[model samples]
Target: MSAGDYPQVGQGWAFPPHWVRPVPGPASVVTDHGEERIERSLQVLLRTLTGSRVMRLGFGSGVDRYVFEPRTPDACYRLADDVRRALLLGEPRVIVDSVEAVAAEDADDRVDVVIAYRIDRHRRPNSLVVPFYLAGAR
Candidate 1:
């Protein structure tokens, strides 16, 4: 089946559930399919976005390096655009509509990223928001 046909109703092998409380054990196992795949994909995307891309093997290819900046609002906006590009380049099944990043009101070191996109075969637009912190920025 094509990527567009992912999470096929009971067709694809089940993937582990994305979330688990405290710690994951045998009882934490959960079957995932259909739309669940989208959620999982988003989780993967987030991980990739938060990590730095390494040329060598074992290192994740991500946009985290771009996430750090001058801490200006305009910088955040550029970061969002760079994130959108990164996601599109990384995931073929995703058609990105927009990526918006706004500085957190309560924290100067944090920015909230809102991503809007649609899957290849899915009609509805999906959105996810992630807050990123400038770890070493002062």
Candidate 2:
């Protein structure tokens, strides 16, 4: 089945919320669908901190815990585990294949989180690289 055919992974307002204005009409909020929608949802989930949302106190990945910690192997492994767990709980449409946290080659303060996944029953696999910044890491 196509991505659009999956009801569980339907359309939603795009993340990093922005407005789009048509040539002959008013501005409207941008929307996302299918795989793009899921990717954006994952970005949101990773960016949010646990307990930050009043209604959904457990709705985030809590990766902020690593922001000030050293970018060691142990830290990377923990971060990967946190991401995998968060995605499993927050997003039901994806089956995670792997999550890896590795230091960025070009930047000392950046860690690249590589996530490999497949949506529900589809055979095609997808990947996303999210950069985690360690602003105060030593």
Leading candidate by lDDT: 2
Q: Which stretches of candidate 1 lie over 4 Å from their true place?
A: 1-29, 49-61, 66-68, 135-138
Candidate with maximal TM-score: 2
For each candidate in the order shown, give its overall lDDT on alpha carbons: 0.64, 0.88
lDDT of 1 by residue, 1-138 (tens): 334455443333344434444555444444455555665666566566333445533233254675556677677877787677667666666778888988888886888888887765556777888787764257
User: What tens-digit string does per-residue lDDT give for candidate 2 at 1-138?
Assistant: 455566678877787789999999999998888888888889999999999999999999999988888878888899999999999999888999999999898888888999999887755899999999875344
Clashes of each: 0, 0
- Position 101, candidate 1: lDDT: 88
lDDT of 1: 0.64
The ten-residue window of minimal lDDT in model 2 covers 1-10
